[model samples]
Target: MEKRKEILNELEELSPILFKIKAEGTDKNIVVPNGYFDSVENQFLDRRMQVENEIDIDIPTDYFDNIESAVFAKIKEREIEEESKTPKRKIINISRGRERVRLSFLPLLTKIAIAATLFFFFIKGTDYFKSNQSIEEIDYLASISKTEALNYIAANTHEFETEQLVGIEFTEEIKNVEEITSEELNSYLYENINELNEEDFSEIF
Candidate 1:
């Protein structure tokens, strides 16, 4: 009892607010919002995965077992001392500082402006470089040989309007027909026997 009273007297000397709070007992139960722990449990679990190694803190084995009794005893000890004391109203005054705070990002803003100007200059310079390129530079498309262009067009005939594109110079007239000998006709018939049906064979014969 003497030790408890001494502890309360020491606590009152240290913090009167704590002393007053001890006299008026507060609710022990802590209220949490509905589903608060449920919602945050997954987040904590995810954060746990990011940590590669387990962090170990050295704790006394008997710390939790004795902590509740220790806290209760201290509060009880304060209460006895607080019952005899009368409460005083505390007045608090809050006011702003006299000097205005200077903007922190002025230097950053200056650097950004400089960067933006340089970026535009760089873009404009690039465009000027492209526009003022040497006129004497080799023209690859103009250097293309006529034969190569013609071959390219022929190879990719479907890609171009080939029939409409071709003119008199590119077209060739049919040569005079040459008569086939009897043996040649027989050879052609033998080769194409399956291809020609009775109607075609009749027309040919």
Candidate 2:
């Protein structure tokens, strides 16, 4: 308690004005020195005037009014530019794809057509060569024997005419006669007696 009293005494000694104000009643009017508030009011007015004079920044009247419209116009122009670029990019891509497809397929189709044409010509040429071959050449190539051919001709002889069988140099004259023995001549005479003429009988006699 004594230490608390000593601290209070020290605070009272340090702030006598505070103690005096506390002793004065709240109802008492506080007094000011002569022209004290007037000096303070003059200082404030001077400071305000100096600040207003130092600040010389000015703005055009229409700047704020058109700022929103200018910003929106810029945004709209950017959108239109992007819209225009989109179709151009798509067109370029599609054209490139079509060109690639044509380049890839054209050569393949051409090669297939050429191959088909070559095959057709090869087959036709083979058939033409076979058709132009001679019958003798065909028979030789087929390994047919002469006897087989003669037998086939003989079997179909009715189809051939007498003129076609005989040569252009054939003659009706006899070239020679072979001598016959008496026994053979006698047998022939006896066997052909009915076919004999008077001239043949005269010669035989």
Overall lDDT per candidate, in order of appearance: 0.40, 0.39
What does candidate 1's lDDT look like per residue over 1-205, in tens digits? 5798898899899999998787676554667889898879887877787662354344456755764454334334434443335233222121234422121232222222233333333445334324443422112224333343334433443553322222101211101001222353345447656655565544343
Clashes of each: 0, 0
Tens-digit lDDT track of model 2 for 22-54: 557544576788989879988899999999778
TM-score result, candidate 1: 0.17
Q: Specify the poorest-scoring 10-residue window by lDDT in model 1.
A: 168-177
TM-score for each candidate, following the candidate numbering: 0.17, 0.18
Model 1 ranges with Cα > 4 A deviation: 1-9, 23-30, 45-205
Q: Please report how far candidate 2 places residue 24 from its true position, in Å.
A: 3.9
Error of 2 at 186 (Å): 99
Which residue pairs collide, candidate 1?
A: none
How well does model 1 score by local distance difference test?
0.40
What is the Å distance of residue 33 in model 2 from its true position? 7.3
